[model samples]
Target: MPIISLPVIWIILIDIIAWTFFHLLISVICLKLSSTFFLRESYWFKIFWWEKSGKLWQKLFRVKRWKGLILDGTIFLKKGYDKKGLHGTKISDLKTFAAETKRAELTHWLSILPAPLFFLWNPLWAGWAMILYALLFNLPIIVVQRYNRGRITTITSPNK
Candidate 1:
């Protein structure tokens, strides 16, 4: 049912190349945007009632135990804040980290948008595999971003 039905080897090569291209392109585009743009949590970044102010990730994903294992996007492009860990203790520093989390989350979310296009060359099952690949590659990072941002909010809030 694919539009092109490329051979399996070619399809695998193309999938690798395409994902690299899309991820880097999305990262570069996001880098060009002002960090200030991410300062405010948009609708998607808001902690859902079910998220329990992001503690859900700790309880379910044990984010603190392994989130540092995630690669820092700054290593790929030197233009943004380093997310390897908290770099400072000042309120301003925390705010900057929070903003960068939004940027990271948005980049990962955008990176997943092209999954369906793999169907042009891959079979039905492969295309769904691509979708799974996208989520598996990006969702944990997104979870870390949201979880860290929620923790940041707790620190920066006055009454909490």
Candidate 2:
């Protein structure tokens, strides 16, 4: 007999699917709540900011090219995706949209937090695989959010 049975494999698959669904669902909920409760300058967001992450992402991933592809391929970061269905042309609107993007990026990071807990129920390889999946899905978005927010901030700054 194999180390893991077919029924066990089915259970693992179900768990992975459920985990992905809950992760996305909770992320959306948090994103919605954050729009009302959090500000662009919120301390929680500031704490996570690493000047190095942005540099690393740019150097390692060439996020600008990926961002362009993503923007073209998906509704993400596109105009009219906002709740008000407005695009950020004006400085104030751009600032608001930047803040919203930061909130969303933070939510994605938070959503990944539970991945390691899968180890409690799953084999080591399976648990790590889920964690990798979570990171792969969210890291690019996080990098893009930071990159765009930086540009928006620079544009909106009084000194600019």
Candidate 3:
């Protein structure tokens, strides 16, 4: 018997789409809530521990050149979206927003990990593929957020 029939393939595709949609919803909700609940620097937003991985992603995607240009186009990071005036352009507001934004980006990527669990009914390859797809889709976003946050931190630092 085939591992994945036509119907099964369609189902798998739908499942992937559903997971992607769910991930987006959760990410947005978390992003919004982070502003309210985690408005200040927290352990979750620490970059010291993840700096190596962030740098790896930055190098892999050359995020320095683009620096979250695609994400900036979205309303999430748009000016005045956070109601801090001028869309968080001020140094202090920008720093806080950057921290929350970084947390949101990480949450978005991490939420996709469970996607492969939905594919457990399918063959191993299907589950693995789902995992790979999740990583591929979110890795760039993570990299961009990390790169942008680093720059923002530098700008906001008092010594800088």
Candidate 4:
């Protein structure tokens, strides 16, 4: 049996330590800085920031272009809300802003690390993985919002 070289062993140790530190460091930074990302409306919504169940989902199937997904989704959803008689800037608009802002903040925060980390994980994956994971994991909440808003529009519309 062949033994690993001293330099190779040192490199492995360094990589492991660095990787753990970087991962935890990013999570902490994101948590601390998240308050500035959302609205002041309610405490219930803040749970979205700290939820852990979505972590695995984000890691498994994060979108390659999350920024675009966010931008387009916000636009698409906002249009639906608008045509349904919802105030564009009050409800849907604010939600869109919060989602996009949070997405960008998380992506930018993760990008603060050195080049190796970004390249090693694929920049697209690293940047939008959280946002994608949030979408996938939060689909139920999204659907509820859409359904509730749609119902409100229906009940309030005069044409009905």
Question: Best candidate per lDDT, number?
Answer: 1
Q: Candidate 1 has which clashing residue pairs, if any?
A: none
Q: State every prediction's TM-score relative to the real structure.
A: 0.93, 0.72, 0.69, 0.31
Residue 140 error, candidate 1, Å: 0.4
Q: Would you list the clashing residue pairs of candidate 3?
A: 79-87, 80-87
Query: Model 2: per-residue lDDT, tens digit, 1-160?
Result: 2244346677578667868776666655664574555454765554234545356567777876767555321244232234223275898777676777666677678878878766666667777887898798777877777766665666676755
Clashing residue pairs in all predictions, respectively, total 0, 0, 2, 0
lDDT of 1 by residue, 1-160 (tens): 8999778899999999999999999999999998768887578777676887789999999999999899989987877889887879999899898889999999999999999999899999999999999999999999999899888888886757
The TM-score leader among the candidates is 1
Q: What is the lDDT of residue 107 in candidate 1?
A: 97
- Residue-level lDDT of model 4, residues 1-160, one tens digit each, is 1122235455456545755566455545544554445434344333242323234223434422241233322342232112222345555554554443344334334534433443233344432543454444345333333333333333433456
Determine the C-alpha RMSD for candidate 3 after optimal superposition of all C-alphas: 4.7
| Model 2 weakest 10-residue run by lDDT | 72-81
Model 4, global lDDT: 0.39
Winner on lDDT (3 vs 4): 3
In candidate 3, position 17 carries an lDDT of: 81
Cα displacement (angstroms), candidate 4, residue 50, comes to 31
Reference-based lDDT, residue 104, model 3: 54
